[model samples]
Structures are given as C-alpha cells and as structure tokens.
Target: MSSIRAVLFDLDDTLWPIVPVIQRAEKLLYAWLKLHAAPVTERVTIESMRERRQQLMASDPVYQRDLRILRRTVLLEAFADAGLDTRLVDEAMEVFSKARNEVTPFADVLPALENLRSRVMLGSVSNGVADLDAIGIAHYFQASVAAHRIGCAKPDAAIFHAACDALGVAPAETLYVGDDPLLDVEGAQKAGLRAAWINRVEIGQDRVLPSHVTPDAVFGNLHQLEQWLKDNDPLTR
Candidate 1:
C-alpha cells in the first residue's frame, strides 16, 4: 500500500512445489549411497535417514537453520558407522543437491515474474538451501538470501531485513510473497513488510492461519498478485 518498491519471495513452495523435489532427491541420494557406500545402505533407508535428520535438528536446533550441515552430518555419521570413507559425504551431497535443484515452477510463475520484474525490484528470502542459480531463475532476482547463509531463518526478521537491505529498499516499501501462513505471512508482517499469501488451492483446506495472523492480501496465483500490484500502485499501472 505504501507504493511497493521491492518484492521478496520464499523459494521452495512459493515458486515451485518442493515436497516432490525433495522426495525424488532423497530417492536418488539413497540409490547413490546404496551403490557407493553399500554398508551404510544396509543399515539405513530413506525414511530412516529423514528421521535421523529430524532427530539431529531436535537435539540441536541450530541444525534446523543449517540444512546442508544437518544433511552432511547425517551422511558423515552413517559413513563412519559403516566404516566407509567419510570423504564420500561430499559426493553424496553433490548428487542430492543436483537433484534438489531440478524444480519446475508453477504455471503462473514465469509469466508473473516477467511482468513483476519490470515494475519493481525482485529478491528472494528462503529458509531452505535451494540453489536458485542451478534452478535457472537467478537472473530474475536481484538478491537471494538463504537462512543458512544469513545465520537466521524467517520469523526472526533478520533474514527479511537482509533481503530488503540487499534490494536497497525499506521493509515498509516491500511486499513479501510466500505460501505459508505463519512462516511467510506473519513472519513478513512481523518484519515490517506487507505480506501476501499465495494459496494456489482453496483456503482453509490444507492449512489455516492463527486467529491473530492476518495477511495484507491473498491470491490463488502470481497472475492475481501482479494484477493487485498494478491496481494498488498507480505508478506500476
């Protein structure tokens, strides 16, 4: 409403669905482990590996912010237990990272990005370790902030502030677009930026926000968000 000069996004679910991508990556990583570190595979399954990651993060919350470290640590520990060369952790991560970055954006994503970038500066702030450059959308954003790199995650405000600083805009003049109600909408609002919830499906179906959390706007697709921008900001219109 204050004439948005910049827009920051949450990468994983905002631009593209992440669950399937991670699932596929995990499958590939597990296959790779089975081939190279056979002993580790004998003791570990993909589901159990995921559980170990969860347990590790539960023990030391810092791993929740540093996903890469959490993943590598899990692999390293598995390698150690199996008496396999721990150096294979690097190769294992490379395999997973490559598979993880292969993302297909939502149908409305590219068209809306092309339209929005012409109107305002675009940046991304994500808690996940998604490689935007590898995903081939790096050129669309002026800045990309990852929680692991910034040492803070969303809902903390520092990650959002980092993105705004990188974009050379004040939080009040930026709109943060994301899919999560609490992590993205409430988090952005708490960080002093306007929040727009991008719910591709029917609302209150899969998830609902707390009674106290209210987003500035909500849309089903990026096209609607682009139109909202043009309607709200006359300069862009």
Candidate 2:
C-alpha cells in the first residue's frame, strides 16, 4: 500500500446533504426574484427553471462542470424569456450563492478533519460552488480546489491531479473521501489516488459500485474513516 501523506475530501454529499441545500437555495432565489425581479417569477417557476437548467446542461457540456456559469446562463435565459433586464442574473446569483453557502456540515466532519490534519495534509476537492470561507470551515483546509475553478469536474482525472498538485503530493500519497461511487471512488482511482466512500445515507445496494471501481474502503462517515486510518494506516499512526 502507498503510505498516505495527504487527504482530499468531496464537499457536497460527503460533508453535508446537498439536495436540501440546493432546494433551500433555489427556493430563496425564487423568493428573491419575486421581490426584485418579479417578471422572472411570472414567466418561470422554480421547477421549470430546474428543467431548463437540465436542458441547458445537455446542450452544453461545459455547464456540467461550471455550475456558477450555468446558473447565470439560466437566469439570463429566463429573464430574456420574460422580456426583463438580463442584468438581474448577477444579483439573483448572489442570493442563491449566499443560501448555497449556508450549509451545515455533518456533525462529525469538523472533528474528523481536526484529527486527520494533525497527521496529514488536508485539502478539499469539490465540484460544488460552496465557499469554504463563507461556510466558516476554510481554516480547516490547507488547500481547496473546485471543479468550477479548474473548468472540469470529478470523474475527470485532470481536476484530481490538479488537487494533488496543489498539495504537493503524488495521487497515490493521498486518500480521497467522498460519497459518490463513480465520481469519487472511480475518479480518484483513475487518478491513482486511494479512495474511501463515506456512505452516510447507506445507499448500499442501490449504489452498487462496479467491480473495477470498488473503493479502498467503505465508511459510514468521516469519523469511521478517521478511526480506520488511525487503526490501520501506518502514516496516521
């Protein structure tokens, strides 16, 4: 086994449940639009906006990695459809971004990071647009790399390599922890990094990982991953 010297983490479902966060943010965004950009509400409902975003994402592969731009594009399109000023996209984005960053991480996340940092370099490899600084967990991470910043998302080796580069370590020297089997485990493996899947929601059978994409370990949460490292990994000891 390659001795782990660094740890990289996925942000969304790994640290916090992301669907609720996006739901709340989108709701707040529409409410904000109802107050300031009312015409958008008149022409666009939140559900329809989601469908439109999916359609846009299908048409533009770039948007799949760049959510900030995708959301802005959707806002512009919606405003244009309503014959309203396209300038409100920025303001609407701000509202959504603020809400998006209002995330409450898993209860075990802070403590696990604290424990792991004492033994190894810690970094964030996220595809989502969560601002660590705004989320008040920025101090825990030495390096933070995001897909939007890199113009590529997880399941792509380039973004993972970029993150390893940021931490001055070979991919094999880092253990990547995340929730998704494909994007996190498979991607990290492809990039030559060991992976641990944090299956907090326990979608065990439903998320049957392929034999080729099997993770190095399956953890119930960060705390379990942390404990397993201390108990088994030589570097952590």
Candidate 3:
C-alpha cells in the first residue's frame, strides 16, 4: 500500500440508491406532464413510457452502448409519440434532473466525505449522466468523469485510466470505491488501482467471488469505509 494521493468514487448506487430517487423524479415529471399535456397523458402511463423507452433503446444499436444518450432519446421519442410538444421535453428533463438531485444520501456519506476531503484528492467516475453540481456535492470532487462524456464506460480499463490520468496519479496509487463488484472492483483492479466495494445490500453472503475481480476491501457503508481508511496505513507501500 502507498499513500493515497487521490480517491475515485462511483456514482448511482455507490453514492446513493439511485433507483428510488429516479422513480420519485419520474413520478414528479409525469405529474407535470399530465398538467401540461393532457392528450399525451391520456395515451401513456409511466410504466408504459418506461417500456417504450426500453424498446426504443433495444432497437437502436448505438443506444444499446450508451445509456445516457438512450435516456435522452427515449424521453424525446416518448414525448413525440404521446403527441406532446417536443419543446417541452427539455423543460421536463430539467425538472426531472432537479428532482433527481434532491435525493437523500445514506447517513454516513457526508461525514465520511468531509473527513476524507482534507486527507486526499477526491473525484467521481460514473457510468451515467449525473451532474455533481446538481447533487450539491460538486465542491467535494476535484474532477468528475462520466462515461457518456468520456466515450468509454466502466468495466473498460480505458475509462479508469482516463480518470487516473486526469487526477495526474498512477493507477497504482489511486483507490476506487464503488458498489458493483465487477464494474467497480474488478475493473479498477484491472486498471491497476486498488478497489473497495461498498456492499450496502449485504448480498455477498450467498455469492461466490468472481475470479477476475476480487475487491481489495469491502464495506457495508461509508462509515465502514472511513474506518478502513483510518485503520490501514495508506502510506505504507
């Protein structure tokens, strides 16, 4: 182990439970859509909208690779198909984005991040289109990398390497913290960085470890992550 000059984090499930947050945001967006476009409301339910979005993405080869673009494209197509004005799509997306940002992180996130901030350079590497500024955590990161912007998503060594390059640190000296075992841990390891899994679900109990991507450490939450940082001599190589 060496002193951690930088720390990279994963967004979505790693920072907070994204599914519920997005669900709530979509609900809010749908409510707004109902008010603004009555005819569209008559034709599509939220569930159906989601299904159509999936179908549209499945039919498009490029969208199958980039989820962020797929999301935007899906929203546009859904609005068109529902006979809604296309101009409102951007407004609706903006509303949903703001609502998505109002998510409550796990109790441990802020305090742990506050503690680690002074100790190391922190940044985020996400596979989706999360704007850290929208989430009000932008100040905490020195850099934020998204897969859509980077042209490469996680599980790809290039993306991890790009993050490391942006940080001006070698991968061997950076520690990446993420929730997914394969995408976060294994991917980081393959890129030559130490990886820690934030296993909030307690699902590791019945799972056999995958051969290619073992995590250097695992934590139940940010509290455990802080403890790991303090206990380990990060400076010892």
Among all candidates shown, the one with the greatest lDDT: 1
Task: Write model 3 residue lDDT over 1-237, tens digit each, in one string.
Answer: 566788899988887888888899889988988888766777778898788778976786556446656766767776788777788888878888788788777777888788888887788888877778877898988888888787778889998888888889989889999988888898899899999988776423234457766688888788787777777845421
Where does candidate 3 have its weakest 10-residue lDDT segment? 201-210
Candidate 1 residue-wise lDDT, 103-162, digit = tens: 999899999999889999999998899998899999999999998997888888999999
- TM-score list, all predictions: 0.96, 0.95, 0.88
| Clash pairs (backbone) in predicted model 3 | 1-236, 1-237
Q: Please give the range of 10 consecutive residues that has the lowest summed lDDT in model 2.
A: 201-210
Q: Which of the two candidates, 2 or 3, achieves a greater TM-score against the reference?
A: 2
Off by over 4 Å in 2: 202-206
lDDT of 1 at 82: 95
lDDT of all predictions, in order shown?
A: 0.90, 0.88, 0.80
The C-alpha local distance difference test score for the whole of candidate 3 amounts to: 0.80
